[model samples]
Target: MTEEEIIRPENLVYKKPTLLNDTPMHYCPGCSHGVVHKLVAEVIEEMGMENKTVAISPVGCAVFAYNYIDVDWVEAAHGRAPAVASAIKRLWPDRLVFTYQGDGDLACIGTAESIHALNRGEHIAIIFINNAIYGMTGGQMAPTTLMGMKTATCPYGREADLHGYPLKFTEIAASLEGTCYVTRQSVHTVASIRKTKKAIRKAFENSMNGKGASLVEVVSTCNAGWKLSPEKANQWMEDNMFKFYPLGDLKDTATANDSH
Candidate 1:
């Protein structure tokens, strides 16, 4: 079929999100950042918030999100995306504001900023990408690195006596009174991707509706950092990662309020 005929509305099964620009992403092979970016772009476009959205990108693998997603973006210092997002959201209450951050940036250096922002009930969403290890920084041990998981900084595996346990920031966010929604999700399969997309949409809606803070943690994979192929990485995440960071809504005050 001709290109035009193949892309006709009636013949289309799916299409790329209009908010996703043609710029090539710099993520490593099998990186989860690309998929999450696409989902964010899709959600923004679907909500008709393309012109009224502001994204905060901080240092890490997703720092370059502004290059691909066609949205107003602010580049923040390492671990400070939450603070910047809070300022932006407060200044422009009508805009849909969010921060895209990796585990190392959110759970480690930005721990205080993240906690306070969510605790204060900022009208914004935080998209947390937890791949365990620090993917962009030479695969070092991250705050969310699973116990016993090997990384460059933990060649002999993470020892409880030396490294402490992995931080479950999502659970912490859920416990905060200011948080209206919190969910842990993944994109390893078609079904999981669909669910994650739904979770992201709900968080965005809650933010725009003057609800309290929301967080969507995506349990992700880093094949290069883990020294595994794409297929093996997916399997490893399913077998190992999910055991500790199981998927589901940790809190859902938004839906609860709606039902009442």
Candidate 2:
């Protein structure tokens, strides 16, 4: 077959997004972080927001997120992504600003910063990645770690009596008046990946539309931390994590919400 015949747009099933840099990803094989990063880049490219998009990436495995996504980036302290994004959004209200954070960073050390920023109705999209346990931080018990889930910090499994219950930060975000959109999603399946991209796109659109704080909580998995293979990790997430962090929209007031 001729190269032109094989490379036609109709024949192409997929193409790498330009917003995703040429750098090789450091994420492990089967890591959802890589997929999520691609989704974000695709959304930005589709919206033509590459130049205007400013991503604030905080601590944890996602701290190096700025390395992958080709856009203006600001590295925030652990749990300070919301605060940083809030400032950037305010200083340049016309710019599309967002934060990519993990459970340990958003729900734990930066809980107050995340809550207040969302409560105040900042025009920012918060892409919160909830992987249950602290993945990059030695698999420690994060605030969103399910009860009875074992971790490096909780060797015998998390006990409600000592560790407390898992925090539903996204649910809280939905309840906050400052937030205009809040949803929980995953990137394990092809269908779920499409939904997540839509959710992320809506979030960025909301920021540009001045819909206030929009949070898209992606319920992810950590195979290394969970001591499971990528396949088992995804399966475990579907079986157990979904119960605690179910998929679907928790809240939506964005104008584009009705359109798609």
Candidate 3:
């Protein structure tokens, strides 16, 4: 069979219910955002939360995530997904609420919103994708950009003196008394993707259980921003990003094991 026939629409089995409207994605080749988008949809299907779930889209590469994840979603102002999530969850306390955001939007522009949201102990799940650099804004230096990392605006490589240290968001979230679940996982490999799906599902479950705030920080890849092939990009995330954002549960056991 031809390659097209191998991946035909009918050949694909979507076992889970997806609220995502039918539309093609605009992500670059080898982008992990697409994989993550699919994982969220799958989790929503598995948990039967698509009808009662609401997602919040951020301002970075994933700003259009609402189009791909089958669920009710709102577009939040840059760096304000957490705030938007708080508002939505407050209004509809029974809904399973989440926010899909990138490092640039979550760690930089939205730092205040993020910190305050967690501090307030809102009932919502946060799906944070840390790709290191700014993927959408022409590969600029993001707050999570590692030292010695090269980006369009940092051709000389990011330096501690100038760019500051890599922000450990999971660690920060873990410190919050209100945060119920905090885990850092990756989507760079099959094993890691399996773990990431579990983390995502756990976060959603925590939200449904009214367990306060939950954050799953996904160490994802930005192939275009990193200027690496898909294989190399995944390798970089596994080797480098994993060192900084280790995979595991960082908070309460109930929320951590909710998916299981």
Clashes of each: 0, 0, 3
Stretches > 4 Å off in candidate 1: 1-10
Total clashing pairs in model 1: 0
**Candidate 2 Cα deviation (angstroms), residue 138:** 0.7
- State the TM-score for model 1: 0.97
RMSD of 1: 1.6
Which lDDT value does model 1 have at 200? 96
Query: Which ten contiguous residues of candidate 2 have the minimum total lDDT?
Result: 251-260
- Whole-model Cα lDDT per candidate? 0.95, 0.92, 0.86
The candidate that wins on TM-score is 1
Superpose all Cα atoms of candidate 2 onto the true structure and report the RMSD in Å to 1 decimal.
2.0
- Model 3: residues with Cα > 4 Å off, grouped in runs: 1-17, 253-260
Tens-place lDDT digits, model 2, residues 1-260: 79998999767878888888888888877888999999999999999998998999988999988888989999998899999998989899999999999999999999999999999999999999999989886999999999889999999999999988999999999999999999999999999999999999989999998988999999998988999999999999998999888899999877545677
Better of 2 and 3 by TM-score: 2
lDDT of 3 by residue, 1-260 (tens): 78898688766654433454568889989998888887888888889876898889979888988777767879988999999889889999999989999998998999999988987889899999999989988999988988898999889998898878889988999999779888888877778889999989888888888888989998888999999999999888878888877888888756345668
TM-score of 2: 0.95
